[model samples]
Each structure stands twice: as C-alpha cells, then as structure tokens.
Target: MNRRIGILISGRGSNMMALVERADGYDVALVASDKPDAPGLAWAKSRGIATFALSPKGIGKAGYEAQIDAALREAGVEIIALAGYMRLLSDDFVARWRGRIVNIHPSLLPRYKGLDTHARAIAAGDAVAGCSVHVVTEELDGGAVLGQAEVPIEPGDTPEILAARVLAAEHALYPRVLKEFVANERPNPA
Candidate 1:
C-alpha cells in the first residue's frame, strides 16, 4: 500500500501542487496550512483531498504544532512534507518526525539557510543557484540534501527573475526527490 502523506504549506504552495499532481502511487491524506487563507488549501480541497487551515497568530509554537499534530495523526498521515511552510517547528516536533519529514528549500541549502535565498545568492555574485530537497531536522534547512537542481545565474538578473527560475526547478526537483525518498525510506518487509 502507498504511504499516506500530509503536506504543510504557508503560502501558494506550488511545491504542494506539484506533489499532488504527481502522486501516482501515494495518498495525499491531508494538506494543512498555518495561514487559513493559503490558496493551496482550496486547491487541495477542490481535488477532494482533506485539508486543515489555521493561523498561528497569537498561539505559541507548541500550541500551534499540537493542533497540527492532532490533524495529521487524525488523518493517519505517514509522511510529512513541508512545502513553503514558513513557521519553524519546535525541536520536539522535529525530533518526533525525524526521518519522516522532508522539506524543499529554495537555495542549495547549507549555503543560504534562511530567507531571501535568491537575493542572497545574487548579492554574493554566485554563478549558479538552485534548490535542495532534504530531510527536516531541528536546525533550519540543515538536513542532508537528497537532490539539487542548478539554475545558471544570468547577467543582471534580479532576485525576482532568479526566483522564478529557481521556483521552476523546485517544482520539478521536489516531486522527483520525494518519490524516490518514499521508495527507499521504508523498513524492510519481512
């Protein structure tokens, strides 16, 4: 049987959309968002996928994640994919999911760990920039990279332009990596 997956997104969730489109043998059990109005939640709902949308607003991180945990568990989610999820998960939450959580980062990770990756790369005058798919750990974007897709930096390219290119790469790279990840991450069936 295919694993039941839950996707967490904060914004438009292009990567989540990519996963939904290519879910050949997997189940999208749920798509949850920290922002109640995240456009992606509606898209998931339209596809008949169960969704949970809430705002972290005044709630502390622990409280917010507790709600998320309940939702994912209630749905019997087997894997958690973070796609454009802006909030930072607490260490305890990260530990609980350890190898079961995967995230996609805009930059090639370990290089641009925080926000504004495209602009950071452009400011540093890097010739190439890309995205990374990795396991989610306690540290931000510090997990082992499973795959990367490089986009050449064109001359006079602004962050917006570079971001567009990188986003395209992410849409493609994330799905491919996620498929393989699920295939290999299983325990041996006896």
Candidate 2:
C-alpha cells in the first residue's frame, strides 16, 4: 500500500505542487499551512486534496502545533513533508513526529543551515550550490541528508538567480527522496 504523506507549506508551495504532480509509491493525504491565505492551500483544494490552514499568530506555538498534529492524524498521514514551510517547528512537534518528518532545504546543507542560503553561497564564492532532502530534526535544517542535487553557480548569479535554479532542483529531488524514505520506514503496527 502507498504511504500517506501530509505536506506543510507557508507560501506558494511550488515544491508541494511538484510532489503532487509526480507522486509515486506514496499518496499526498493532506496539505496544511500555517498561513491561512497561502496560495498553495487554494491550489491543493482545487485539485481535490484535503487541506487545512490556520495562522499561528495568536494561538501560540503549542496550540498551533496541536491543531496541525490533530489534522494530520485525522487524515491518517504517515509522513510529514515540509515543502516551503517557513515556520520553525517547536521541539515538541519535532519530537512527536520524530523520524517521520522530512524537509527540503535550499542549500547543500551542513553548509547553510538557516535562511539566505543562496546569498551566502554566492558571497562565499562557491562554485556550486544545490538542494538537499533530509530528515527533519529539532535543529534547523540539521538532519541526515537523504539525497542532494548540485546546481552550478554561474559567474553572474545573484541570490535570486541561484535560488530559481535551486528551486527547480528541489522540485525534482524531494519526491524521489520522500518515496525512498517512506519505503525504508518501518510500518506502523496494526
């Protein structure tokens, strides 16, 4: 049986769209977002995918996470994919999902752990930069990498230019890695 995956997004969810379009060996069970007005939610809804969106602004982190957790469980989601999800997950949330959460980072990882990855790579005079799909942990983008795709940084590459290329790589990398990850995970007990 295909594993059910829930995707979390904070914005356009271009990665989410890619996953949905190219899904194999797994099913996208739900698309949830911290930004209620996120464009991704609408796209998911239009495609007949179950979606839940709530802003965490006033509910506090704990409450917000609880609601998200409840929704995922309710949807029978076995894997959580962070696709352009900008919010930092609380340690509690990470611990709750543990090995089942995965995220795609814009950098090669173990290099640029936080934001501005493209800019940092350019400033450091790096020749190549790419994307990584890794298991999500408490530390920001600090998980064991499952796979990576390298994109050469051209001489005139600005962060925006580099970012666009990396995003394309991410779209291709995330689905394949997530499929392998789901296949490797131990099945839940009946």
Candidate 3:
C-alpha cells in the first residue's frame, strides 16, 4: 500500500514541498499547521493537497497535542512527518506515535541536539555539519537516527551559509529515508 503521510509544518515547509514533488509511491493525506497564515498551507492548497490549521495560541500544550492526535487519527495517516514544525510535541503524543513519526533536524544528531545548532557548531569551530532523519521520541531530537548527509563547514563560514547547505541535505535525505522505510516494511529503530 502507498504510505499515507500527514505533514506538520509551521513555516515555508520546504521539506514538505520536496516530499510532495518527489513522492511517487505515497499519498500526502494532509498538511497541517498551528499557524493559519503559514505559507506552507497556501502552498499545499495550491497543489490541491488537503490542509488544516489548529492554532495553539490560546490552547495550552496538552490541548493542542490532543487536537493533533485526533486530527491524525481522523485522517488515517500512517506516517507523520515533521517539517519545520517549531513546537515540541508532548511525551504522551510522541509515545503514542512512536516508530511512526519522523523528523528532519538541521544537525547530525547526538552532536547538536537542540536549537541554534549551526551557530553553536560554527562558534565551536567544527569542521563539518549535516542534517539527520530520525524517529521521533519524547526527548527532543533524541531518537535513533535513520540516516544523515554531511557537508563541509568551510573556512569563515557563517551560520546562514552552513544552514543552507544542511537544508539542501535535508531536502534530499527525508524523502530517500521515507522511501527506504516503506520499502523495508519495518518500523525502523530510527
């Protein structure tokens, strides 16, 4: 069966767009966001993909996560992909969907576990940078890694430059990983 995917985004959703354009054996069942004005919603709509918005502005974290869970179940989504989704999901939610949700992070995880990774790496004078595709876990960015693609941190490189390079890898890695996941027919440890 074609993998049914639901993507959650909070911004431009470049990775989501990449999946939509490249996914030949999968169905993008829904594209959802917490921000109604998120550019990605409009982008998804333009491509005739279903879109949803649930604002967490007033609703607390638990309430918001509850809604997300309901939404995913209602849509019959088999795989959940987080693409630039800024909010950290609740532990209960992550556990409920463990082995089914995946996220693309801007750093080769276990190295730069949280935000500002590019800057932190550059400031620390790291020689290389990359992105990771990993299974989602309760602990932020703490999951078994599926795959990663690295780029050299050139001399005098700014965070912005490094970020762009890493994002390019992200755009390529996520879909490839998803394809492998579907082909293997297993809940990969990552």
lDDT of 1 by residue, 6-39 (tens): 9999998899999999885578999999999999
lDDT, candidate 3, equals 0.88
| lDDT score for residue 20 of model 2 | 97
The estimated TM-scores of all candidates read 0.96, 0.98, 0.94
Candidate 2 lDDT over residue span 47-71, tens digit each: 9999999999999999999999999
Clashes of each: 0, 0, 0
Worst 10 contiguous positions by lDDT, candidate 2: 181-190
lDDT of each: 0.90, 0.94, 0.88
Ranking of all predicted structures according to lDDT, beginning with the best and ending with the worst = 2, 1, 3
Q: Can you list the residue pairs that collide in candidate 1? A: none
How good is model 3 by TM-score?
Answer: 0.94
**True-structure lDDT of candidate 1:** 0.90
* Candidate scoring better on TM-score of 1 and 3: 1
